[model samples]
Structure formats: C-alpha cells, structure tokens
Target: MSSSTPVWPAGHDRRVLAEVDSTNAEAARIAATLAGPTWILALRQTAGRGRRGRAWNDPPGNFAATLAIPSGAAPAQAALRSFVAALALADALTQATARPEAISLKWPNDVLLNGAKVAGILLETTGQGGTPGPLAIGIGVNLSHAPDPGTLEPEAKAPTSVLSATGAAIDPESFLDLLAPAFARWEATLRQHGFAPLRRAFLDRAARFGEPITARTLRETLTGTFTDIDETGALVLTTAKGPVAVQAADIFF
Candidate 1:
C-alpha cells in the first residue's frame, strides 16, 4: 500500500489496511486490543455512520478512516474528542485548498468548507478501563463523486466537494498524507491542553454562531441562538429559560 509516497502523517507508523466492516465498527472492535493510532482506512465502507446514528454517505475513494487512541482520557475531553479531529480536518482541507479561511469548523464534529459540508468527524468509544478507554476518531471527507447535492437531507445545507471547491482533483492518499500528521498535533494538543484555545479558534472560525438555529440534543430539540461554546466544547444556547450549556446536540441552521 506504500507507493512512491510518505505514509499518512509522514512518520507515524501506519497500520493502513482495508476492511469490509465500517471504519468506526472496526475501530471499536480493535480499540481495546490494538496499539495506538491504528487507522482503519478503506476505499469502500458498506455501513458507514454519522452523527445521531445517521447513515453516512459512502462513496468510493472518500476517506472513511479512524484512529485508535490510548486508554486514558477525561470524560469531558473524551466527550469533546471530535473537536480535536475537527481542527485537524480543517487544517487538512486548508492544505489542499491553500485557503484556510475557506475551511471552517462546525460545532460538535462537522467540517464546513466554504460554508458547505466538506466533511464530518465521528468518534467511537469502548470501555478500556479509565474515564474513557478506547477511543477512535472516524473522519469522512468528500474527496470525489457523490449524490447530487439536491438529494441530501432537508437539513443538509450548502453541500460541496473538494474536487469541485478547489477546482482540482484530490487523491485520497494525498489527502490522508496531508491530514494524518496535522491531526496528531491537534489531537495531542487537545489531550494535553484542554480545549480553551482550540475552542476559541473554532468558535471564531465557526460559520454559524450567535445565530438563531435549531438543535437536537439527547434530551429534546431546542430553538435558540448559539451564544457560546464553552471550553469543554459544550454549546451555550440562549434558551427560553436562560442560557443553557449544551453537552451534545445535533444542530440545524
């Protein structure tokens, strides 16, 4: 699988391989049994997933990869793990387009490219032993062909593709090569330094903040303006009662 190329991240050992199982599924299964950052990157995924357990679109050559991490992370950090991956993905797309401003971070784990959904991050977890044991970050980037944007979900807004956005074709290998290492730095940063700086930057670059929107949390749906994103990645919404810090929510603009 190694071409005339540097591996993803350049130096980190890549356990790059294909699998029939969903990348998230494979990551969860092996998270406890495997070593660190063993990536399950496949050219095809039969049962891909997205936030809120939605069926994620799986087109060939698109990135369906996840990284297995060690077994010692705080619940709050673990709860907000996607932020690390989100930041990493933003950096990756920025490299591909050379337009960092064009790529923005969506709360939770979505990646917005030029205001459209270019990618998303999903985390799979298993009980290893600690606060949050086995953790795997599953990321999917629209690198190539896809269903017409018109067919996307009702809530899905301005959709786009890398090949379309940057006006250049992007190879999955090239994208990963650029993403993996950049991801490690952000991932490690979140693990060590909490998410204050990253959260701030993420909010600043966030496409939608302080705007009236709808959110579906574990509890129920709420319509409010996005007021703040706290350090723990909890979204603060100006709800009817007052300001509520959201732990997890499926947001809609």
Candidate 2:
C-alpha cells in the first residue's frame, strides 16, 4: 500500500515505511545519528511492542508510529511526555469523531472511548553512561480494526476502534494529520508552563479518578483510591498505609 503523506513542521524528519519490525526501533536507529525530533511511521509493523514488553499487534491500516526527540528535562520530568501524548491523542480523536464527550484518558497513557480502549502510548528512552538521550514516544491507535477480545493479553483492557466506535472509516495517515499538530500544541504547553496546567487538563479528561483501583508494579500489587498525579507526574494512590507515589505500574480500574 502507498503511504499517505502528511505535512510536518519545519526541521522535523518524518519517514513513512511500508513495513517494519517496529516503528520505535526504527526511530531509535535514527536518533543515534541525528539530533532529531523524528517521526517514523509504518504501514505494517511485523513486531510491534508496548509498555512492559508486551506485544503490540499492528495490523496494516492501523496507526503505528513513533516520535523521537532529544530530551530537554531531567529523566523524571522528561517522562511526563507520556501524559502529553495521551492528551494530544484524546484531542485528535475527539476532533475526528466529533464526540468530545465520548473520548477520555486513562491514567498514565491510555486513550479510551466510552470506557473501551482505543489507543495506547509507549515511551522509551536511550542514553549513554546514565546520561539522558533521545526519547522515543510510540503510539498505536486502532483506527480501522481492533484486536478481537480473545486475542488480547489477560492484562490488557477491552479494545475498540474508531470505525467500531464512531462508524468512521479513518485511515492511519489521515489520523496522523490530526494527531501530529495536536501533539505539538501539548508539547509547547509542557515547555512553557510545566506540568501543573498539563496535570489539570489531564485530570479534567481523566477517567475513574477517586475510585478504587489496583496498581500492579514490578514488586507487588497495591490497591487504593486513585487520588492524583503528583507534581512530577507520579501516580498518587491513597492506600491504607498512606499515599504511595508510583513511578511506573499497570493500573486497573
């Protein structure tokens, strides 16, 4: 299939591929040589991946892309871009479907429509000698098709698609046209004000806050009331022990 061309901002390197092992991997390769805010897009990813090393099934026609950029903030603060990605995607989908109320963001970086997962964001960083390097932000949205319920991993949330949810036959390229600029806007907000306003906007569209939820971390599982994300973007859980700040975890609501 011929790749669709979308206009990108100046100084940005955007590459569209017919097939690849993973867009994130490709972006990482580019980051090694170029000090780029580069975007790598794949029409079909033979071996896509997600957070925590889970396989990301990428069928042709779905959105599979990664944006790699140099890090400007400390490691902890740079991680907040995941939230920026989530908010950008939510905005783009809301505009595409014309259903602002139907779209919402789950904690961390999952985008949902009417409580079903429509897209996911994965952020990976490369560095040398403990020094921060380029950051690759991977995003996969189910535009034309979603995985069958039975095919999803046990930990994965229920999945849906733009076609299924909105009855709109949106393609990956057309979706990028909406997503790229929306992402730029949020990135600019993060650069100017910091996470305070971004956190507020994230909470405004956040789903299932102040509810009982389970957070499965690498060490153990913690159940608590979902309270808020701290100033640095850590998940704040009101557990029996106290408010636990989680830097990374798989959340279940």
Q: Which candidate is the best by TM-score?
A: 2
lDDT of 1 by residue, 1-253 (tens): 1233334553354555555568878777666677556666777888888877887787886777877775646666676767777877877777777788788877877888778888988876775456567777788888886547666777776667887777656777677887787777877777588678778778877867878878887879988888899766788889889998878788888
TM, every model: 0.88, 0.93
What lDDT is obtained when candidate 1 is compared to the true structure? 0.75
Residue 193, model 1: Cα distance from true site in angstroms:
2.6
What's the CA RMSD of model 1 in angstroms? Answer: 3.3
* lDDT by candidate, in order shown: 0.75, 0.85
Query: Per model, how many backbone clashes are there?
Result: 1, 0
Candidate 1 ranges with C-alpha deviation above 4 Å: 1-11, 128-131
RMSD of 2: 3.1
